[model samples]
Target: MIEIVEKGVTNLELSKHLIKRLNYTQWKRINRFEFAQIF
Candidate 1:
């Protein structure tokens, strides 16, 4: 798996970069983590 944080632009562009690196499984894991944090 790739690191969640990357050295890049500090805006939507960076989000795009990070998203591109994540596979479906990684996305699900991250989504679950964020969901848990909200509860």
Candidate 2:
């Protein structure tokens, strides 16, 4: 039972890390798009 709980915690942390990475990439893309429009 303890192992199951630990596995769940690990999965949660992994997903959170992935989400942060995805957000950073998306923000960079948006900045590039806006910069292009300005010129």
Candidate 3:
């Protein structure tokens, strides 16, 4: 059905956003840890 397809698309977009956010957070943590070690 058309509604199901739309829901799937919405879910995919949401998942992508969540993944990007998580990746950004992880990268930030790694950078902070490295900086702390250097200092």
Candidate 4:
């Protein structure tokens, strides 16, 4: 999804912003999921 967004986004600034936001969101979500399973 992030890769698709990056490719589809024409504006450089918007692409950069989305990339950072999506990456961080995915990271946080994955961490939370893993932490939950650890219990």
- State model 2's lDDT: 0.54
Query: Which residue pairs clash within candidate 2?
Result: none
Clashing pairs in 1: none
What CA root-mean-square deviation does each model show from the true structure?
Answer: 6.2, 13.1, 13.1, 10.1
For candidate 3, the TM-score is 0.33
lDDT to native, each model: 0.54, 0.54, 0.53, 0.54
List, residue by residue over 1-39, the lDDT tens digit for candidate 2.
Answer: 356446665644544554576776764565545544543
Report the Cα lDDT for candidate 4.
0.54
Lowest summed lDDT window (length 10), candidate 1: 1-10
What lDDT, from 0 to 1, does candidate 1 have? 0.54
- Residue range 1-39, candidate 1, lDDT tens digits: 134334544545544555688786776676655644543
- Clashes by residue pair, model 3: none
Distance from true location, Cα of 23 in model 1, Å? 1.1
Better of 2 and 4 by lDDT: 4
For model 1, what is the error of residue 30's alpha carbon versus the real structure, in angstroms, after optimal superposition? 4.1
Task: Give candidate 4's error at residue 21 in angstroms.
Answer: 0.3
Residue 8's lDDT within candidate 2 is: 65
Candidate 3 per-residue C-alpha lDDT over 1-39 given as tens digits, one digit per residue, 9 for 90 to 100 = 355446665644544554576777664665545544542
Off-target runs (Cα >4 Å) in candidate 2 are 1-9, 24-39
